[model samples]
Target: MKEELSLVIAFDATSDAFAAEDVFRQNGLSGRLIPLPESISAGCGLAWRAESNLEKELTDALKSIDITSAHIYYLIL
Candidate 1:
């Protein structure tokens, strides 16, 4: 079976990650806040997980909140 893939958006700050979650919720994007996965080691302790195909929508939403420096990763989840 193929592994499912998802997008993980990590911020440099925990507050930013939480803020991004709020933005995603406000925009009606389906996602959740989770602990930063160990596979990726370059972000705050928190991350936002969402469908991989929603990159464009996520990017636009993050941009609206002036959060332009998040580390984005595509991972098998």
Candidate 2:
């Protein structure tokens, strides 16, 4: 299988992560909650994974919820 680049959104707090999940789901965005990758040294042990192409949409959705501490990264997963 070919590796693909995905967008990882990490949060400083678990509540923020779950809150973001709700916002994403409500907006009909595509992504899921995942354990924070070992390579990443941030967040509350949970992260959100989504297609890189959804960065803009994700950002907009996040803004609606006042979520501004998310760290975004592009990596093969």
Candidate 3:
């Protein structure tokens, strides 16, 4: 098996993380909650990981949910 790049969204707070999750769910987006990678920094230790190809969908969902406190990153996992 080999690693692949994924979309990682680090949240500034747990509320924001949950919000993102809800938004993704409501929008039929694909992703899961994961621990924030050590390579990234944020107020919350939780993050949403998704396929890199879903970047646009994820961002749009986040926007609809008014989650502006997330830091988006692309990391190999």
Candidate 4:
């Protein structure tokens, strides 16, 4: 399979993660909520996986929703 570079954003709570998901979807940003990978941890059990290029878009979306403490990780998945 072709390797896709993804930005993994994790939060401290499911609500925060879901909130981010909603904003991104509503704004046409690209990403999806997924189970927290074994590779990273942020106290929350959920995370978001998005294309690398969408990092800024994700950030902006989070800003619109007032979500913070989201750790961003870039990796091939």
Tell me each candidate's TM-score: 0.90, 0.91, 0.89, 0.88
lDDT for model 3, please. 0.88
Segments of candidate 1 deviating more than 4 angstroms: 1-3, 42-44
Instruction: Point to the candidate with the largest TM-score.
Output: 2
Return the lDDT, model 2, position 36.
92
Clashes of 3: 0
Tens-digit lDDT track of model 3 for 20-55: 899899999988999998889734389999999998
TM-score winner between 3 and 4, please give it. 3
**Residue pairs in steric clash, candidate 1?**
none
lDDT of 4 by residue, 1-77 (tens): 88888899988778999898889999998778888988796443988998888887889889888887899998788
TM-score of 4: 0.88
For each candidate in turn, give its C-alpha RMSD to the true structure in angstroms: 2.2, 1.8, 1.8, 1.9
4-72 per-residue lDDT for model 1 (tens digits): 899999888888988899999999999998889989984439989899999999999999999999989
TM-score of 3: 0.89
Model 4 score (lDDT): 0.86
Worst lDDT run of 10 residues, candidate 1, spans: 35-44
Sort all candidates by lDDT, best to worst: 2, 1, 3, 4
Question: How far off is residue 63 in model 4, in Å?
Answer: 1.0
Error of 4 at 30 (Å): 1.6
- Residue-level lDDT of model 2, residues 1-77, one tens digit each, is 88899999988889999999999999999999999987787443999999999999998998999999899988899
